[model samples]
Target: MNDMRMSPNLALNQLVAQRRAAGESLVHLGFGESRLPPFAPLMERLAAGATRNAYGPVAGSPEVRAAVAGYFGRRNIPTGADQIVVAPGSKPLLMALGLVVPGDVILPRPAWNTYAPQARLAGKHPIAVAIPEECGGVPDPAALRESITAARVLGRDPRILILTLPDNPTGTLAPPALIRELCAIAEEEGLLIVSDEIYRDVVHDPATEFLSPAEVAPASTVVVTGLSKSLALGGWRIGAARFPHGPWGEWIRSGVVSVASEVWSTLAAPMQSVAEYAFGEPEDIRERLRASARLHGAVAREVHRITIAAGARCRPPTGAFYVYPDFEPVRAELGKYEVTDSPTLARRMLDLGIVVLAGHLLGDEGEALRFKCATSMLYGETVEEQQLALDAPDPLALAHVRSLLERVEEGFMRLVP
Candidate 1:
């Protein structure tokens, strides 16, 4: 445990906080936290249940489980309350999957920073396959078979394949065809799928065809989601998982619940009340999520435009609020400043008042001149300002938001010019 470092995103957030405390002006793009104000009714729900403080079921209260079950059911993945397990956060649920699921894990080369570390901590190897050029969540389908065979030859047992729909780092959603192809690979390889759909609700376009692995291959997929990304409830730590319905699914859920009982005990009672309210998907909560998604999409596209114009190769963010930009196009220009790799690129940007998570931290190759810039944090510095941005017809045009975008543009331009 001592050998494992703090999660890269969290660590970067802390660094940004420390710098800000020392009075530095920094455009913080290092964290993927949804920088929106909390919904009022959810807060009311939290306060309403504050008095009910006793330990609830380890798997979660029945009401919250059923609510989560309904949440999955509405998404076309039919679920039962027995198939759901609510945890403090999806991180713990993911870790539990790592511990109980047998063998090494297969991950996209540059995945969310936590997957590989969690695999290592769970005493399993993480096999990273490069993602398709179009997205960053799933392994490149052409490479999946060969990578699995290679791992086996090296004495590693690869049993689980984890995917992030509308991925972090590079916030592009995998198209339905891509998802079907990957699910086929998982089926052929006899691999269990852990679909991290935490960002499912944050799709930029309402017409975007978002597909979940559970929908394609429900027999072997476990879908994990939380209120953190969608509802600006990161600190609340409310997450739930929907296991496939079968004997194997039951077995896995039992293992996770046993682990939960020993670790977090249960999702906090007050948070369970909040989860019930949020997952119930009331009209007002739905409206809030929709507004937040619009704000995220607008700001992310603006950042994408800035990165491209400044000579970086980036996927236009289609979901979530992150942009993974590769600076190799400007490698020659960056070389003048000794910025040869992701770390140096991030460091140079930091010196110029922009904060981004280096690609290497998210398990990209150390030599790649790439880093992830989270556009979500560009919304505003205060709750009131964030609300105003959310309510604005053109958020990116607003002065407070535009200044942050300009900072990103200026920082990248300095690297290239």
Candidate 2:
């Protein structure tokens, strides 16, 4: 606890907030939050349940769990209410899983910053493997096998693997074939898989292919998701997880519930009401997700173009609202401005009134000139404008949004050229 500071994403959000509060005009692309207003129905549910004040169940109310189960069922995964657990947020649920799950953790090189910390808190060593050239969430399959072998040879126990669908920082999804290959490796090594699908619904293109490890390695995988990104309900603090069937899955779910009982107690009574309503996937909720995805895609693509135009190589974003751009190709040019590594590169951008999360913060090599740029914050600043962005046929056409994107492009043009 003493050695660990606040999570970099959260810390960056705070720094940006303070800067803005003091009247600094800056473009914030560091935090990975789904910056949208809550849907009215979801908020209504919270207000409707305000009268019901009780701790409810540690694993969440049977009603909400069933709603989450139905959510999975509709997605083609057969789930039972007994296999679901709801908590204040997926963060705690993930922490509980880390605690109950044994041995070391294997993570994609540039994963959510939270995973490595959770592994450390659980007394497990986190082994980092570079992701495949095509995606950011799952590790490169061949590299995964080699890393596992190397860890075992060094007398380490690599027992678990974590994957994010529509990953943060990179905003790209791993294809189904890669998922299957990774699942095979997990099965071969007798490893448990934790699939974080919080951003599953945030895919920019409805036709994009997504495969959950649970689908391929059902017996060995558990899934955790929440309304934070899907419904823009981050502050409401509602999260749910679906465990697999059979004895092994049952045992693991029990452990997480036990931990939840002592920790969060239960997702707040009002939020459970919110979860039950949101997880039911009403048509309105579905449409809101669709609109949000559209807006995110528009902003993210423009950011990618700006990076490319500035001579940085970036993976095209297909989901979520982030783009990981590597400035290594322009390292010599940036060196003229005293930017040599990821940290300095981020600082130089911040100096230009554009804040980005440096790639090194996400577990990449510090010397590499890379950073995570989040486009979610570029949406209109007010709820009215946000609603306009949601309703607009082309959010990029909105003057406020376009102005911000212009701010980013102009900032980059000055620094790079």
Candidate 3:
């Protein structure tokens, strides 16, 4: 699908690779990968099941499905084996959902880039709505209503809204009240809400509540999550979706399965084994999630402080290991360097041996001097350092990460000045 949109993260990595090839000593803040170590048990499980050769069911293995159901149950969201669809990644599952659901897609302007393109590939228009000031994922309720009315007048049928909690670039989780308000609007508009809660488990504050759209509007909302971010399992390519229970749920599930049969067919046997273990909701997995969340939160906040101190405008990070920084505060200085746009600022960072994704890559205005900094990549060159930081009484005090933070702070200072 040449006309389809490519993922901005992937594109950023490509740029990083090109810069490295040119011998630039770049600080990679581009891709948002969890540089944490994977749970040893999951690796063991995969190794034990690596010998299976035959393809399993198109939907997924029964054991994995059951585990996913139990996993959701642990979160107070009731689900069953039939309600889950394990896929290569949540990205494909989302693409399939766009195809299954009718009408145009509604997305927050600065969102995960794939949402809009996936909708377009499914032959639906993608309508961008402005997000609320406090959150960067779900569209503001007022903007949502106005956008729908405007689209309807223009003869567009807006039927789906994609919400990313603890968003990719912004790293701010939508408040439960905000989710409830958006859910109410979705109900009124007869919209199907796709809650991309991939980063939900990575909440920095244990007390910050996360209310799934399905929890607020189960009748029409679907939840999508995977182990990629939280578990540093991006390479494993295991993800799942949870649909509401009903006739429509069955239809959606069937559609996803049908799409799976034509595409990936089934997740690898080894990855399926890992998925079963991860989705089983074991004590070990719980501990792993908690540790990962703590590490991500700690590192992301450090980057947030650095960027703000450098005179960049940004929101306080709530979850995920990212910070969206707007360099508009230093617009005058940036213009002096001929860096008046996101792309220009991105190149300038690269020239300074720093790498970050421009805000326009996440569907923001192209001319805005903004970008997403992924703090997870700052984990030192070895597992010992990461583990030590994770186990340290005060991770921020750990030398390795603190050094990286210092580098970032210095880099931003140089850029802005």
Best by lDDT: 1
Q: Tens digit of lDDT per residue, candidate 1, span 1-417? A: 543778878888889889999999998888889998889999999999999879988999899999999988888888899999999999999999998889999999899989998999999998999998889898999899999999999999999999998899899999999999999999999999999999999998889988899989988999999999999899999989999899988989999998998889999999999999999999998888889899999999888888999898998899988999898888898899999888899999999999989999988999999999888898888998899999998998899988877887898788777
Greater lDDT among 1 and 3 belongs to: 1
Q: Higher lDDT: candidate 1 or 2?
A: 1
Q: Tens digits of per-residue lDDT for model 3 on 100-120?
A: 888999999788778777877
Structural similarity to truth (TM-score) of each candidate: 0.98, 0.98, 0.96
What lDDT tens digits, residue by residue, belong to model 2 across residues 1-417? 633899988899899889899999999989887778888888799899999797698888889999999999888789999999999889999999999988999999998899998899999999999998898999999999999999999988999999999898799999999999999999999999999999999999998878889889999999999988877778888888999899999999999999988877888898888888888888998888899988889889999999999998889999988999988888888999999998899999998999999988899989999999888888878999888888899888889888988999998898787
Error of 2 at 358 (Å): 0.7
**Pairs with backbone N, CA or C atoms under 3 Å apart (clashes), candidate 2:** none
- How far does residue 210 in candidate 3 sit from its true spot (Å)? 0.8
- Model 1: weakest 10-residue lDDT segment is 1-10
Ranking by lDDT: 1, 2, 3
Instruction: State each candidate's clash count.
Output: 0, 0, 0
Superposed model 3: Cα runs more than 4 Å off: 1-6
Q: Which ten contiguous residues of candidate 2 have the minimum total lDDT?
A: 1-10
Question: Mind sharing the TM-score for model 1?
Answer: 0.98
Off by over 4 Å in 2: none
